[model samples]
Target: MEQYKGRAIVQKIAAGRIWFYTKEEQSVKRYRVEDTEKEWKRYEAARDEAVRELNGLREKAVRELGEINAAIFEAHALMLEDRDYSDSVKNIIETQGVNAEYAVAATGDNFARMFSGMEDEYFRAKAADVQDISERVIGILSGRRKRKKMGKEPVIVVAEDLAPSETVQMDKSKVLGFVTRQGSSQSHTAILARTMNLPALIGVPVREEWDGKMAVLDGVNGLLYVDPDEETLENMRKLQKEEQERIRLLTEYKDQETVTKSGRRVRLCANVGSVSDVAGALQNGAEGIGLFRSEYLFLEADHCPTEEEQFQTYRLAVEMMAGKPVVIRTIDIGADKRAPYMEGEPFHLEQETNPAMGLRGIRLSLEKEELFKTQLRAILRAGAYGEVSILYPLITSVEEFKRAKALLKEVEEELADFGIPCGKVRQGVMIETPAAAVLSDLLAAEAEFFSIGTNDLSQYTMAVDRENPRTEEYFDSHHPALLRLIEYTVKNARAAGIPVGICGDLGSDESLTEFFVKVGVDELSVPPSRVLPLREKIRNID
Candidate 1:
């Protein structure tokens, strides 16, 4: 027995015997036969059986994991009925004169490859789902299947990977946790593990000969202790209890305000990307939308979003937020987040050798004034429904903010000319660059508010790309230099009588909660799930 390490998806702890699930594929004989109809019937029967099993799993998931998580099975059910997937299997069986098992196995690989080729990480993970469902059909057709009954006690599931379908279908009661060799923090397996509140570790090294081994899976620190000594087990028990107690304590602050011991109030808000996230954020007790990433609308579209398209999206968000202030960031493109449609002609950002430092954010908008104005018009129209404040991202200079503001004014004049009723929208700037932090006083004088984008500032100040894992050692957000920049920006923003906030991954870092509260930070905008935990941290700190 040996210890293994991996990335933790859900923070929890469990000690159980390993239960290895293996999918053994059968070699189906392929030949030219006139029995195409027979092969079709065989494929249909296997598909129907798979769907029936999936529906049963969906029901169990709803009972144990809740409806949102159970939807993964529903999607699997739909995929079985979807013509694109089903028809492809049928076509391959009929045309190639192969058995249902071989047809599905071949078709699944082809379809999964398509998703794996895509840029978006979300869609890339969906490829696993496609393959998982196909494997079910193959399993039935090849006369191989999972055990109909589970063991008496729950066991730790060790696998190469667990797709959404496989994850939802597993007997949750008999599965204490999961240990996988391949998966990311954002994989569907991770998401489901979080939903089920199960301890899970991914990216563990593959071990072909470790079945029935007793292992203490520590999800909090992402370590797996195989055949641990009594002392190790005792230590892990204490840590697990502490973690459970911490979670219980955090639940008490789900609806509490993030006021420091000094009685200074700090706004706890969520950085949402779309309207879909608004409901979850509110459920997690988000006071308001501190950063509405408006770039997703542009990034997801095939071309530039039309004024009405952008208007409706923004309006839905504002209306959903009700009276809460929603700081909508302007359409920030280029860099990692690129609008492929603007690759040529007026915007040749695709050719940038270093897009990370090239024309992006406010700089890109200033170059394409029309694109910036279209978004401004939509944001202003949305402002009519609620407290919608505009924030320009990647503002390194006062001149960039000034020019963007002028275009916004031009959009307002045009909207007014067209008999459109708009509300007064407060303009703000994102201090994401070292230069911006240095010029915060000048920017805050003109801007109504400031949201510090620590992700960018740390990268720029340290000249290390936070996205690159290789540079993670050097990409320290807690660097004294970075903190000083944040402290200075907060002071400058306060001097100009403007509210200052931090909107980045670091916003939820508990270690920095006291520091942020000390520096007179007005708000902290983090992911929806962090709203309550961060609030608890702030409320406990002065």
Candidate 2:
């Protein structure tokens, strides 16, 4: 028996034979080509073919995984048409007088290297994207398909790494789980695995010889047992049964109120990125929509989503909640979450040395008045359909909060002037920074409610970039200082006679549930899947 430890992407258990995924190798051979025009034409043909394949995969991703995940392939398609990338391939082929495949391979390597060398974690992740697209085009040129076929039965797929496109193209039914030798938690493969609700592990030392061997993938413990002994298998089966029984028991609490043994009640909500996530929230008995991340509607688009587009999306979410209160945060773009279209025209976002602390959230909204007003109008209009609260992100001071509210009021007046029916929206502020937490009392006086964004609060309070892996050890979400901030924020909110909720990763931490309840947190909002488990935890607390 062999035991290996890895990082878990999704917490689940699966037992199956290992299947080593072998990608078709495209060995590009460099050769002198006399006909430069012919080579350029060949490259163009391959690019077109690759785009077609990407589009097909994108459609599949949309049908299985929603539009947000499908955006990965859309990006690959756009990368194929990027002028710098395509121009480099053309230049190498024409000037160097080399075959199209070799030129493409060379261009991919150079671009991937450049991206890999970038300091920003987001940009560094793009290096893998460049390689995926490059390999795709090269495969087309070489008349080979990059996607590998699975066997007849389900198996645990073992691979060095998987591109987003490759993962989406696989036969999902044939896949029991995934164990990769190399991948980060932020990798698209990890995201896809979570979306697919499949158990997955990364950073495992996978071996080709382990193929076809019985394996137990214990995602909860991040362990993989290859050809495990009888006793190990028995213990694993017992654990799996317990997990299944635990899940069954959780359903009993789904329809029950989230109240403690002492009869203390709290609102348990879900934070969703898109409208499609609302169904899951309802299934898991989310009392309301806590943090509706409105940025996704902008991020997934090639251009700025018009006021009507944003309105429809927001309206759909509100309506889906079926009269449940939905708190919609305004477009929180910039920093890691960037829209390419915003880089041009009137909404030009300048490059920043420290983007995380730069123009983002409410700052970007305030700087771009028209953009801000457009969203405010949509949220107000969506409010007519159902209960909707407009929450502004990154509120560092009272002045910023007042300025944002002033704009919202102006939009309401504009709607009234135009004789448009606009519903009243509850105003709220996101206490994400130390300044915001300290000034919560003043802001809460004017704001209807408060939502503590613990993710950024911890980051800014600790002066650590949460997304940067190097800062992982230092980035403490449960730091004493962060808890003090949350306690302070909640205390202020209570004094101001306004409810306060947490809408960050920390809200989902079951270990902190009792602490939050004890701190007088009015609500705990987390991902849809965590709602029931959190509710179960809340019920057990005194």
Candidate 3:
């Protein structure tokens, strides 16, 4: 038996036969159109057909997969209806006199090319979605078969890449796991696996010899075992049984505190993005809400959300927590994010070559004080309902922390003068940079609390973008240097007598639970689905 290593996106274990999948390539042929008006009509008709198909797929996906999976087709429907996409195709048809199929292909290629050239990997991955949507329209225009060839029995699908639309159409029951050569944690394929609770490995090496072979997809370690020996197979069975039992055992601790065997207690919280997720958190036994990402409010709106609108949302979260602490991270938008609502003239998101290091997080908030203050006032007012803490993201220095706090105080005093009811709220900063870890001593001295934003911390410290597929070979969360930075940040917070928590993706990892506990991490905030299991793991730790 030999192990093939890859980056694990969904860390679950599954043993199954391998099924290699390759999508049929669509041929793009340029042909002249005799009538531009007729071509335009054809394109419009195809687009309408595409939208209808997407809507049908959305309903089927909701019934079979779930709401989140169905949302993919919903997005596809929106893309098909987008004026920008339609305008591009219409212009090509009218100006160049190209046939509908050729016009669609050209416009799709241009859009995909734009996305492919983007610096952000998430945006880069979206090129496939654009192509997938165009292909569907083209297929409608040309009468091509577009259905996927799924297996009869469950199998682990190995592929080069799976587009969002393709992933939505997949048979959920037959897909045991996924091993893709081109994908990241943020990719749709990975997201689907995560939602389905399936093992998934991305950036897997291309291997043709292992097809139809029995293999163990060890997603926890990102290893693929091809035709394992008797002893190794037995060990894998034992481990799988233990994991199943652990999951079954975790249900008993649904309402219990996360106290270790030696009586060490830590607050277990859930990282939520929207109000809808709050119920899921409580259902999974989250003691509190650790990280409430506030960027969605901005992203979801055409303009800046009013203080009243933001207040209503924040209040809902605060009241839902019901006096339990809710650390709401202020808008962490950046140039790389390129939010749809913020794409217009008033919002000037710079196109930086290194968007990750450019204007983002606290920097953007400090610069766009008007937008930032709206959220501050809303959060402060929400605190009046229940326990609400403000968390500033990507704080790299003492000055940024102080400036943000000063702004918070300014808002508080402004509200006080107006006699607008606002409560005393705790303030904190996300330690997500190398400098932040090095200078945690200075920042923690002033902040009320700290949350280690491990995703950014890993990216900035290692100088590696986890979203980028090329960096998969070198992106190691278990790297000694990254762990030390986390340790250093935790140590400084502990010495300052302020609570510190890890609110990054790595915090949800089951293997690191003991390491975090030993380092005196005050809390572990993860996704709602992992809260119960993590609590169980914490309870099992000595």
Which has the greatest TM-score? 2
Tens-place lDDT digits, model 2, residues 172-271:
7789899998766544466556545578998798988888899999999999999999998898889889988988889988899999999999999988
User: Which parts of model 3 are misplaced by more than 4 Å?
Assistant: 1-6, 13-180, 184-199, 204-245, 296-309, 416-419
Task: Give the alpha-carbon lDDT of every model.
Answer: 0.79, 0.84, 0.81
TM-score-based ranking, best first? 2, 3, 1
lDDT tens string, model 3, 1-542? 88889988776788888877777556878888779998898888889989998899889968954675466688778988989999999999989888988889888789978876888855654565677688889888887754445658898888887754455446666888899888777543564465456889887786766678888888888898888888877887888898888778778889998999999999999887667678878887888999987875565433345677688788988898888989999988774454432432224576778877888899988987877887899999999998889999988889999999999999999999999999899999899999999999998899999999887888888877755787756778788999999999899998999999999878888888899999999999887878988888888888
Which 10-residue window in model 2 sums to the lowest lDDT? 338-347
Which of the two, 2 or 3, has more TM-score? 2
Model 1 alpha-carbon drift over 4 Å, by segment:
1-4, 7-219, 223-249, 339-348
Question: TM-scores for all candidates?
Answer: 0.62, 0.71, 0.65
Error of 2 at 165 (Å): 13
lDDT for 62 in candidate 1 is 88
Residue 296's lDDT within candidate 2 is 67
- Those runs of model 2 whose alpha carbons end farther than 4 Å from true positions after fitting are 7-10, 14-36, 43-216, 225-237, 299-304, 339-353, 417-421
